[model samples]
Every structure is written in structure tokens, then in C-alpha cells.
Target: MVDTNETHVIVGAGLAGAKAAETLRSEGFTGRVILLGDEREKPYERPGLSKKFLTGAEERDALRVHDPSWYTAHEVELHLGQPVTALDREAKEVRLGDGTAIRYQKLLLATGSSPRPLRVPGADLAGVHYLRRLPHAERLRAVLRNLGRENGQLLIVGAGWIGLEVAAAARGYGAEVTVVEPQPTPLYGVLGPELGGFFADLHRDRGVSFQLGASITEVVGQDGMVLAALTDTGEELPAHAMLIGIGAAPDTALAEAAGLEIAPREEGGGVAVDASLRTADPDVFAAGDLASAYHPVFGRRLRVEHWANALNGGPAAARAMLGREVVYDRLPYFFSDQYDLGMEYSGYAAPGEYAQVVIRGDAGKREFIAFWLDGENRVLAGMNVNVWDVTDPIQRLVRSRRPVDPERLADPGVPLDALPG
Candidate 1:
């Protein structure tokens, strides 16, 4: 039930969309809120798509963002399975796929992102998969749940976060896994060489095979089933199943159509948002993975696809959308549960910008913290993995924004506080 004056339109019903609606209600926004998603099913948690959900360790209930009854109780007019095709910025109306025009007082573009496709030939073969939505995880889960429906080995394309997580899950199911990555080390483009090598070692120790600096020439299949993936080295490996986890691109066609300005990343293709999460067009606000929001700590645009940003960035953006003054600048945080280890982060680490890197513990056996310093040489980002409880001091460093003594940073006896952010 959309009231004429009580309407707020939100596009893309993933994390950002759902969180925006919840935030609006919590803020006493008793207006009509419309939630739209291109996906056919109700909103669900996506981080588990690569791990627990992919391996059948978790059920669909655990993957949902909200229950079916939750939306109705909040009076949100959710249009699941219906994607917004266009935005008439001047008229302040959204054009749905089925020719319905919905008007709104405030428009939130949470149109998230889509899985980047594998460019090699035969990428559309029946066995090649990409993990994004629930259906994708379900299909990939079917392969791991019942090997009888499949055969041979699992060939993974790209050694990214999702790719590696999927590899770990597949190996757990007793499938022979071979990861194909064109880079010398995985995640080197973002996390840097040393950290990438560290991840490579972790995977190798877990019985996963890797083919570094190898390119896929093509994927050969018969009757929709993948048969083999031919590599540039002229070697063909038989693959019963294949998974592509290269990356994701911002779904910004609607934004661009609405004449909103988009910020460009060094790597490419994400829209720009201000410190307040508002687009150049004052009437439109954006957040989540699609918007390259500014980071005061790092002094550059930060666009993170992790759940924390998608969940928190929304309410922050909503506050601004309602003409309330609020800052969305929380230290970026995200986590991943791989094997038996819990990996977490709270800041950025520019590859060469860190004047100093503080390592609290040994990197070999886990339990370590990597802190990055700025050009003025103050703290900018903290990359902590396996630290049971050390984030409090790191958060202090981030707030104090100071540098620590070099010798103390390397010393185990000294508290991390002796060092500065």
C-alpha cells in the first residue's frame, strides 16, 4: 500500500536495500517504503554463498537477510523478482521492467553488482558456474552435495575470495580441485604480494593444487556439460564442473541513465559518492558496493563489497536521504571463515603508501596484525587476521591518528598502543 505523499523508493533488494528500509522504520519514517530487487527470491545473505551455503553446511534459512513475514510487518511494498529498468530523474519516477511507473520523494540506488563473467570461450557451458545469488549457490551446492550427478574434477577459474572459498568447500567434499590463476599470486592486485603469497601457502597446505601464470584458452564441452578446459600452455585438463570467481562489476546502468555522476576507481567502474553518501545529484543518494564512498582515514575513495559496508552504509545513506546530517565513516570491517581460521579487517593498506607496517605476531602460523602508516607516516589502515582480541587498541590508534616508535612496533613485549595510527 503506497500512499501518495508517504512514498520512498529503494532499488535493489540485497543487503543495502533491506537495511535502508529497516533503518527508515527505526528512524520513525512511517512513510510508504518500496523495496525492489531483480532477483526472483526474497532477500538473503550473500557472504555464505561461497562457503557454508556452497558446501551444504548451512541451509537456506541461514542465508536469508529477512524472513518472508518480516517485510509485511514493516509495511514495506517489496517488489521481488521485478527489476527497475530506468530512472527518470527529472520526473522523479522509476520505470519498472513491466512498464509500471513508481514515484518517490527519495530514491536510493542500491543496485549492487553482478558477477564478472569469464571471458574465455565456452563460458556458458552447463557446468561453468558463477556464485552471486542463492540460485547460483544452490546449483554449485548440488554438485558438491551429490557427486553422483557430476564426475571427474573441479576446475576453478580465478583465485579470488570466492574462488578460494569455493575451492576449500569443494575439496572438503572430496573432489579433486585445481585452481587456475593468471597472476603470480592471488589477490595481489588488492592485498599485495606478501599477503597474496601467504594465502597461496595456506591453500597449498590444505591439499589444493594451483596453476599460477596460466591462462585458459577455452572451455570445451559436449551437450552442455564441460569436458575440458584448455590452457595457453597447450595442456587440457578434464573438468566435470567449473566455477568462475573473477570479480564483480557495479550495476550502474540505471544510475548512468538517471544522469548521476559516478566516481571511477583506479582499477575501474564504480560510481562516486560524497562523505555523506549523496551523489552529485542532491536528490539521489547511493551506498554499498555500487558507490565509491570517500574514506577520511585513507584520504581516497573506498568501495567495499563486504557485508559490513552493505549493511551499515545503507542507514548512513538513509539518514542523509532524509536531510539529516550523519557521517558514514566507520572504519571498514569484513570477515571470512576459511577452514578453521577467522580472517578480519578494519582498514585499508595501500601497497606502497605505508611508511611502516606493524606485524604483531608471526605470519606463518596465523595470529598476526598488519598495520599501515600514511605518508605523513600516521596510521591509515589495520589488517588484522587471527587476532583473538586486539581491535580495541587498533581502533584507538585509528582515532588518535598517530605514529608509534619503530622499535616498539616490532617488539612483542610492548603494547601496540606504543605505536601510532
Candidate 2:
């Protein structure tokens, strides 16, 4: 039943695009599968870049999603270092930077996001860095190693996940780390002040300094190399290197240029798509960080930048493209490992969306599950820190959308599965 004459093209050869190609062939698609990427390297997962890779505990080869031979063996037309420059919707073709126009019967845009650049003075200095690609991590690893030996200081602007993870990695290298954030606490926008304070304390105990409620006004450098960072609070923090980790913005240029509907910034900004991950053009689909997909459960559009989204969304879009019924309602999930603490979070709840955050177990010991609830005590999100095997029940609790007794929800003696959802 496969269409032998059809050709499917996937752009941005990241985790999502690579997986989509694998899924198409695995699902018995005999059509031509072309995967394009701007980077010359093979597809790789990104989570390790900030954790094990940066800490020098993992090798580069471990990051690859598939071996180099896998693509050849699977008959996937792998195209690396070929950036897609333009898309012609009417002609059903994508123009590459090399002037090659590849026609497709179906198209998928898996273009991932890029780190938001720091526009402060001296940002272009040699010692100021940003981590988004494999090369960036490789360079940062070397820089940290050299800085550690010289007893240098690392000034990290932004206390988000990447910044904090890099702080932990820098500390592993014996480098002095100081994190500056405009927010009152680390991870304020995601975990809110309650749990954000926990992270601040956690990092402080690990010999990391914090300049909370502050922003870097300028990057001071000497001889085209970073020397220090000046804060808006009129403080100059001495540093041999600086890292800007504010956040990332989705890559949607190809889809946007092709006249695809894009979501507003307030709606999580990306290429807008329905629950099936299909854009208005029908033949074109968007996935991974580039997709602002309609979530059936949340009743809203969500554009997640986590590794899990790309790991799962690609195959979902592949199946949908193959004419299968698909509904992408996966809960927003993410995990972090900073020092000895490892945590997994499920569901979505912005700061104003939840009325109360109830905790089970001892938060002081970093062994607990925190639940964000609405006024009716309905679970909106749950995060388990240093805990294991509770993701299933926690996801069910959020999906149930039912109220539970706060006291019981916080009781360690009560089984989470036994509780009323």
C-alpha cells in the first residue's frame, strides 16, 4: 500500500527530522526519503551537551542519534551541510543553498531553535560564549578546562537551566562560577519563586555565587577577550569567560517564508499547526521546537523546546503524514540534572495559572514531588525531584483534571495511585 512514486522531504536534520525519516522507512514507506541538515555532523541529542558532555564525563560519539551507517543502510537520502534556503509551496519544492531544488510530495519542517543572542557591549569578545551546537559545547569544555587550571572565574548571565547546568559543569572543572539573573531567583519563570529559591540555595551550597535581581549591562573585555561583566546594579564581576543563556527562539524562517501561519508570541510563537501536526497547507507539516502545536488536553497551542518533544513529535508527524490518525496530546515534560539533584517535570502551568503548589515528602532534603493546582485543587503540573517511577501516576493525575484533598496529596503515607484524581 506504499506510494512508490512519492517523495517525502524533511528539513533541519536534527533529532526530529532524523527520527521522522527512520519512522517512515520502518512504517513501510517505500517513497523516497530525503533528510536535509545545515550542519555537517550527524544528528545528535542535545540534553547531554549541558550535563555529561560539558562535565567531561561523556564522549562526543555518545550524542549521535544514529550511527553514520544507519542512514545508508536504511536507504535514507541523507544530505548534510546543505541548508534549505527557500520553499516554493506551489511548486512543491525546497531550494537549497547550493541552488538545488528538490521536489517533494510531502514536506516536514523540523528546524530547531537557536540561542537568543546577548546584545550587550563586548558580547562579541573571544571569551564570551553561547551553547547551542556541538561545536559550541566542545569549545566551552576546552575553555572550562583551561580556566579551571588558571583559577579563573566564569560569569554566567541568566540563571535558567542551561546557565545553572553549565555552572554545575564549571564547578566540576574547579572553576569559580557566578550566575547573574534579573529574576529574584533561579528558574523563576518556570518553577516560580517557591521552588526557584530551592535551586538558589542548592547552587549556593555547591560553591556557586549568585547575583539575583541583576542583569549584565555590559561585557568588559581586554584584547578581544572577556575580563569582567558589569551589572545594571553598578557591580562589576571579574571573570575570565562569560556565558549568555537567556533562552532560545524557535527557528521558523522556512515555514514563515512559505506563507505558513505562525503563532503569536503570546501563544508560544512558532509555526502554527493543528492537533495532527499539519499546517494549513495540508502537505506541509511542522514538528519539534519549530511547531506551535494544538494540544487536545491543554486546549491550547504549545511550542516545547525540550529534548522529549523532538524525540516524540517527529514520529507522530511521520505517522500522520502517512495518512494515519494522530492526535499529539503529549504533556509538556522536561528534566534537569544539576549536581546530585535530578528532577522530572510533567504537564504545564505558568506562574499565574496555578493558585497553590503542594509538596509531598521533605523539600529540604530534595526528595519530593511538588504539584501545582488550580483554585479547585485540580492538578495542573507536577515535578518530582530525586524521586523515581512516579511519572505515570503524576501524568494521570494531571490528565484526570479532578480535584484532590490537599492534605492527602501532601501526605507521604498516602499512595499517589490510590488517591482520587
Candidate 3:
């Protein structure tokens, strides 16, 4: 057990780090808690960036994960804007950017992630942007609004979650938008072709054009401002602004220098941790987007980049640090909102792991729940799109891992809770 006066240092002031600090205090640990962040702002919810926050439906202050008073009242020391520069594992101390060394009894690295940089020729142009931080979202919102006013064209370089949501938001703002994806369908890796194609249709119906199975050779620009993107197919897609939302790379430079185990990049690279969320060094822990923990539920090492994972993993890591027996076994959960569609997914399944997909309600109607099942008829994962109050039942179906009747699973008249075991 950690001594009451022992200082617990948490790196990264995102949701996971904040939640971990909250857990430590709530669990009666009277230790000194220091939360460090490189960002200027305090912990805030990021999911709103692409939807509510960017669309001007939510205020900036409301996006904060916790008010400043909470940290003060809880006696949690927050070091914002100043990033840690070095980790001296031997001395159990971290050096800040200004060369101040702070010692700690235990350390938690939650140094989230940064948006993957676009490598095209004109990617550095003034009008080209990527969404990851509040400032980026704010700038993109302003850009989209300007485009809407002038009826300018908006070009998206990815069809992933950020790309699609921004497309939806841009369309709502009256910008003529075009999304270009190398994949044949949007979200193909996650939802597979059938469902991904449904999303493509959904976007197409909303006046968003897609250049599927297309690759950009270069971003065309003039006066250091992006004007269009040249496709490998010899087509020049005109644009007033471009947003690249391919994906994010885990922020692991600190962990790497400290000699923590790192996972393979293809496997969602991050600091490697055991089932208990502890690194090779017992005094150190990792969580959030930067820690790829061994997931017992999925029976594999998985790194999840979703809000729910960070929310649940933070407390789990904190409990483990306090010498509590903890296994981060929660099924990964994530949700996305696009136009009229809102979706919640639970459980884990690689692209090709689940063979059969059973759907209830009409996909064309945009209100339905779909279940991905393994060969033995066990539900592997499930998602409810534009459906209300069914996530609990869907999650239960995935957790049970029992054979479910395909017919019943696809029948809207049959209740999910009453489905056969």
C-alpha cells in the first residue's frame, strides 16, 4: 500500500489522467496528486469537437471535463501548459520543460495522442488543417463558417470518424463538401462493407460527394494556401480548405525514453502494459490512448481510442497502483454522431473475425441495431444506430457470448432482453 503522503504523479491532463486523479482522491488516498499536461487548457471532453463543439451548439466552458475549482477543492495540483521533458527512472523523477525535476512515488503516463500528420506535398499550406485540439476545432469551425457564407468548397482527405463528422458539420454549415477515401467504403475497417456502404449512402444522400477508392498525389496550393488536391487518377478536386482526419499516433516519446515496453505500431502502438495496467516497472503505470493494455475480455492486447476506454481505464489503473487487484476487462465502447445517425458499439472484433451480421429494423430507415456474430453463433460485437435505450441490451448480448437465434436477433418485434440464450 502506498503511504498517505507519497506523491502520485500523473502525466497528461486529458480525461484519463483527470479521472485517475479523481479516483485516487475518491478512494481515500490522501497522497499528493500532481496532474501534468502539455496543453494550456484543463481536462476537457474531446468528443464534442467534431459535433456539438464545432457546430457552435456547445459553449467552450461546457466542454471542460471539470471546472478549475474541482482541482483546487480536491487538492489536486495541476501543472498545465508546461510539458515534461525527461524521465529519470533511476531517480523516480521527471524533468519539466523548464528543467525543474519533480520526484514521485508512483507515475502514470497518460500522454494521449496527436493527429497523424498528412505527408502530401502541400500539407503544410495555411488552409490545410487537422482536428485534435480545441484550438484546431475552433479554427476549423471558423473556416467552415466562412466557407458556408461564400459557398466555398471543402475537401476532406479521410473518411474516418473525424472526417465524416466534420463533413456532416460542414454540410450543415452549407459548404459544398467532398470526402476522398482510398477505401471503397467509409468506416470499412470497423463496420465492414455492408454497414460502411450504408454510411456512404447516408452521406451521399445529404449532398456530400465521395471519391471512394481514390488517393491524393498532392495538395495543390497558391500563396501558401491550399486550393485543391490532385488525385492519383489525374483528377484535380477543387477546395477552399482541406481537413485531414486519417487517424492519430500515440504520444509515447516519454515512455520510450524511459525504456517502457512499446507495442507494435500496427497493433495500436502505445506503452505496453499487463492485464493490471502496470508497466514492467511496477511503480509506473500507463492508460488512455497511450497505453495498450492486455484486454482479458477480448483475450488479446488491445489499444482502444475511445472516450469510454479512457474513462474506465483511468480508475482501473489508479486502483491497481494502490495495490488493489485490478484487471481492465471492460469491453471497449464507443459512439459516433453524424447528421441524423447516432451509434453506440460495444465489445471487440477485428475486421474479419465476425462472419455473420444480423440486423433488426430496416437499415434504409436509419433506425436499427446490428449484431456481429462469430462462426459458432456467439455474438462478438453489436451496434445500435439511431436507436434509443437499446445499448444496455446490446452490450448484454455481447457479454453473454451465448448462441443467439439469427431470426430472433433480426426481428424488431422480439425484445433483445428476451432473446434466447
Candidate 4:
């Protein structure tokens, strides 16, 4: 039960929004927290969509962050399935799709993001699907079961996370998987060129055919169902089911309509927020993948779409909104387990700027620890495949940010601790 006035209205009931609500209450705000969302379901975990859950190892119940009981216990008002269609910054109120307007003292927008659409012809065909929500996974699962037919092909456009992930799942289910990517390396943008090559080798070795440098020209269908995809290279590849994972675009329509200063998407871009995650309006704050805040160590405002970032940034934004200064200066980290290889890495490795790289094991064995050092031999990133020793040393090194002897680092004989103070 909200007080009806002087409430904190939070938009987008995803991980960031939910975490903010929990933090706000935990900080003794004692104020009304109204959570508004467009999705009917609860805030769900998205990481499993490509891994354990996709392989039928985990269930949908595990995707939940906090159940209905958890919110009820917090005394926060959950306005599920209701979206704030328009924002009145001057009045501090938002107009809903139902034509209802609600005012608030503080507004936090955590409108996460959406998968970028494929602009090819016949994209609206029946067999095409995009992975973003639970309903999407449900539909894709049904499509996977369609493999009872021998000639079915799963055409995945774009080599980004979702596409490759779906490819792994589809292939595991015994479907012909073909990944159409415009870039030479699949995870090139995030993992850097050198690491991206390592990822490419992993997928290629698993029987996944990657059509690199191939842009889909059109999706051809017959009788309102997808038949095959036409590429810019004048090749028509046959397919039964298709997935569009080109990339993700921030669901910024609600924010942009709010007259907030939005930094257009580029190499590193998002809705610009100050140190406090507050927009120009001051009272209105934004977080999660929708809002891009300044990174201290990285020295750039990155619009990261990582799952951990959303979970971490949510609490940080809540503290900031509560007039508590919190800095998100952590080294960005992410992991991907495709096939038998387990990869864990972090931070941004500059283009052609690896001053020194130490490889611990043979690449042929698919077991190694690759360390990237900056100009002064300070560990910028630590990567390990089938090796766990890399994690401990890398975490300590990045936090210390001190000097390290290159000769000692290159030599695995010397304990990792023996390299630097």
C-alpha cells in the first residue's frame, strides 16, 4: 500500500529495478517504492537461456531473482504488466498505457534492453524467433523438438552471444547449425581479436559452421513460413528455423521520450548518467543496461550488457539515489562455457596494445592460461581455459595495480605471488 504521494517510482522490473527496490528498503528509506514494469512475469535470470537451462539441465523456476513472496515481504508495490508510456519530468509523473498518470518524488528507470531486429525481407515469417523472454524460449524449444524431421536447419544470424548460444543448444539437440556473421571473429567486440580467435576455434571444432563476413540479404519464405535466407554474397542458404541475434539495442524509447540526454550507441555508448546515476533532470535516475555510467579504472562510459553488471549496478544506483555515494570501479568480468571449454576473463584489452602476453600451456591441448599485461606489465586481463590457477593471481594483480617483473611473470616456475608486491 503506497502513501499515494511522495513515492519512489521505479520503472522496468528487471534485475536492476528489483535490486534497487531491495536496496532502497534495506537502507531504511521507509518510503513508498512503486515498481512498474511491462513484463507480466517476474524478474528472471537470462544467463541460463544459452547454457544449462537451454540444455534441459536447469528449470525455469531457477530463473527467478525474487519471487512474489519476496516482494510482498518487502512492502513494495509491484505494478506488473503496466508500462510507463510517457514521462512528465516537470510534473514528476508518468503516463501509463492505460492513460493513468502517477507522480513520484524519485524515478529510477531500469528499462534493460531488447535484441536488435533483423532487417531482412521475410523476417516476419512464422519460423523466425528472437531470444529475449521466456515466451521466446518456449517457442524456440518447440522448434527444437521439430528436429523429428531430418532436413531441418537452424540458421542463426549474427555471431553475438545469443546467436552462438542458441547454436550450441540447437546443435546439442542434433540440428544442423549454421551461424551467419558479418565479422571474422564471433565475440570480437567484447573479447578482443586475439581472444575472439580462441572462441572461434572452440566452436569450429564442435561442428558448428560459421559463415563469417556474411551479411544476410533477405529471409525468403513460402506460404508464410521461412524457407531459407539470402545473403549479400548472392548465396541462398536453406533453413527451417531462424534466430535473429544481431545485437541488442537499449529499450530507450521510454527514456528518450522522457527528454533525457541519451548518448547514441557506438563502440561504447548508452544513456549518459553522472557519478550518481542521475540524469540531467536530477531527480530522475537510470541504471542497468539502459543507462551507461562512467567506469573509473576503464576510463570510459561503457554500455555493458553483462548479467553481473545489471545485478551489481542496481544496488549501486539505489545507494546513489538514496544520497549515498557509491563507485562502480570494479574490473568488468564475464564467463562463457561452450562445449568442453570453460573461459573466464575480464577488463578491456585495447586494440593492438598488448605490451606482453604470457601463455601458460599449449593451445593444441585446449588447456591454458593467457595473461595480458599493459605497457608496464600490469595485468590488464586474465584468461584461463581448463585452468583455475589464473583466477586467484589475476584478481590480486588487478586490485593491486602495482609493478611486476616481466621476466618473473613469463616464468611460471616462480609462484604468481613472487612476481609482484
Best candidate (score: TM-score): 2
Cα lDDT of model 4 by residue, 1-421, tens digit:
4455468889989888999999999987777888998989888878887777776778889888897698889888888889889999998898889999988888898988898888867899999999888778877876876752464799999887787778778877778888888887887665556767777777777778888888998999999999999988888899998999988888888878778888855434567886567888878888888887777665667677878777888888888888887787656676777767777776656546567676766667888777778888887777777877567677677667676776666566777776664
Model 1, span 1-421: residue lDDT tens: 3345767888989988898988988887878899999888888778989877887788989978888899999888899889899899888899999999998889899989898888878988998988899988889888865553443488998888888898888877877788888888877665767678888888888888888889888999998889889999777978888998888999888998777877765724667888888888787888888988887766678788888888898889888878899777778777777777677777766576566666768887787877676666566666677776777777677767766665576576888756654
- Which candidate comes out best when scored by lDDT? 2
The TM-scores, one per candidate, come to 0.94, 0.98, 0.97, 0.92
Worst 10 residues of 2 by lDDT: 1-10
Question: Which of the predicted structures, 2 or 4, would earn the higher TM-score when compared with the native?
Answer: 2
- Could you tell which candidate, 1 or 2, scores higher by lDDT? 2
Instruction: Compose the digit string of candidate 3's lDDT tens values, residues 14-76.
Output: 999999999999988888899999999989988999989988898789888788799999989
Model 3's TM-score against the true structure: 0.97
Query: What alpha-carbon RMSD in Å does predicted model 3 have with respect to the real structure?
Result: 1.7
Q: Give the Cα lDDT of each candidate.
A: 0.81, 0.93, 0.90, 0.80
Instruction: Give the winner by lDDT: 2 or 4.
Output: 2
What are the runs in model 4 whose C-alpha is more than 4 Å off? 1-5, 148-151, 264-267, 350-357, 389-392, 399-407
What is the TM-score ranking, best to worst? 2, 3, 1, 4
Instruction: Give the TM-score comparing model 4 with the true structure, all chains together.
Output: 0.92
Tens-digit lDDT track of model 2 for 242-301: 888999999888888889999999667999999999999989999999999999888999
